[model samples]
Target: MKRYPIRAAKYAVYLIILFFILFALLRAFGSASPMSVLWTTSRGLMFLGVVVVFALLYPFFGFTRKRLTFNAAERADDVERIMAMCGFKRIGSENRPADDMLFEAASTAKKVAMMWEDQVRITTDADGVSFIEGNRKEVVRAAFRMGTYIA
Candidate 1:
């Protein structure tokens, strides 16, 4: 939950900028009066606030953790491919700290959409138990892919 505030603040900044642009466009091209545009923009911002709050909060409270176990016969390459197919890119070697493979959303647009909290860390122990950690929705999606692909 500690990360929520930072995410919210960042999103708020973006939303404010978006609303300002909308206001300007409506006033200039839509022939809307300044006060009307201001009112509409304010309402739009409020609606966005509600939506963004729910989006950011749901992962913390509403999602279940997902995990996968890969036997010795399973290759990490296959796992990487599934992750890539699911829109993840492996973190570069220089930053990887352990046997753990770190991944983030493959595209800048996705990173921004996820508010940059789209990391999915997979660390397999000697027993082949791989723990998945990060934003819940992405983890669940990746786990589902890995499960189906590796099965």
Candidate 2:
């Protein structure tokens, strides 16, 4: 899986909001001693760290991986073009154990928006069955477009 180091601007704004919310909650329900400030800050930082980790992992665990099987007569090139129409650009192909074609978001901004899950890997078997593994929305969109035009 390829990683997009830069994230969308909205995510940074969201994280800032989350940090403030965590700090406010900690201050409200915390102890009322002089050292409570330090304690609350530490606890809020820890909680924020956990939330950030969960947000980072959400893309990997939250999406469903689906396979779209095309007819034997449909050419791989046609499928590649459909994927392009669906907002993915073919990076290249590799002769792995299975026939694999790799694709990424069409533009740099789209790639940043997708973050870590921008690349979609399509594996075509000898029987013309191709499995598209990526974010569920992207996979489904590509599958739907291919089905509409090719079927």
Candidate 3:
């Protein structure tokens, strides 16, 4: 499963809010002693800290994250290269296939293309192109520009 950075961040924010709410409730209804309040607050902070850490690390550790970089132009070129590698031939208007197998293959190919598209993003710069994945936008040069072929 993919863990989106924005989603993780939102979850972290929610956890922080919940921790504060719990701390407040505990303070209001629990013991009035300084030690008890401090202990409760510390525990709440620890829980919030753990959530924050996990959120920050999720992008780096997520299995669905593809760590690759390319600029807009290079990205376009890569797409072309990948299409060629996948043996994707351009369908002519006059020779369009009208069979069920063709339709299934097209649908499957569209899904695979979408998956690759989602795995990478291209950003342009004066220095050239940069690729970004999720929240970590870093320029990587050794990306696998290969498309998946569904038979």
Candidate 4:
């Protein structure tokens, strides 16, 4: 959650900007004192700005569309094992065995158009393996932690 601090800082700055802008607009056209106008509009305008920002960003960051690859340093089987240890379930193995390597990030009961989560396709063979896309650092950390939890 190191990113949380950065995001929070950005939000704080935005709120301050919004407060000043609203205060200025209200003072320019209204009869109220600057301090009185701020007292009246500050909280409501700040909340509105924050809501707009959140609504715009929630879908973008909460459900990201990224195609990230694994580095050459990682091995093929190890990658597969790590994926399995994490929550990703294979797409298919019965009709298309090789195609089973394609996986969506979430293993929830409802499967949609794969829009709800990230996806990863692993290409492994006698040749060295590489990933088409995945959340790399978090995936690696989770997989490594799995090693300690196995009975």
Residue range 50-83, candidate 1, lDDT tens digits = 7577657655663345557664124668878888
Task: Identify the candidate with maximal TM-score.
Answer: 1
What is the Å distance of residue 7 in model 1 from its true position?
A: 1.5
Report the C-alpha displacement of residue 68, candidate 1, in angstroms: 2.4
Each candidate structure's TM-score, on Cα atoms with residue i matched to residue i, is 0.63, 0.61, 0.29, 0.36
What local distance difference test score does each model get? 0.72, 0.66, 0.42, 0.49
Consecutive 10-residue window with the lowest summed lDDT within model 2: 1-10
Best by lDDT: 1
Q: Candidate 2 has which clashing residue pairs, if any?
A: none
Candidate RMSDs in Å, in order, are 4.3, 6.9, 12.8, 11.5
Q: Rank order by TM-score, top first?
A: 1, 2, 4, 3
Q: After superposition, how far is residue 105 of candidate 1 from its true place, in Å?
A: 2.9
Error of 4 at 53 (Å): 2.9
Which structure is stronger by lDDT: 1 or 2? 1
Whose TM-score is higher: candidate 2's or candidate 3's? 2
Error of 3 at 13 (Å): 6.8
In candidate 3, where is summed lDDT lowest over 10 consecutive residues? 96-105
Superposition error at 110 for model 2 (Å): 0.3
Runs of candidate 2 with Cα error greater than 4 angstroms are 1-53, 71-74, 94-98
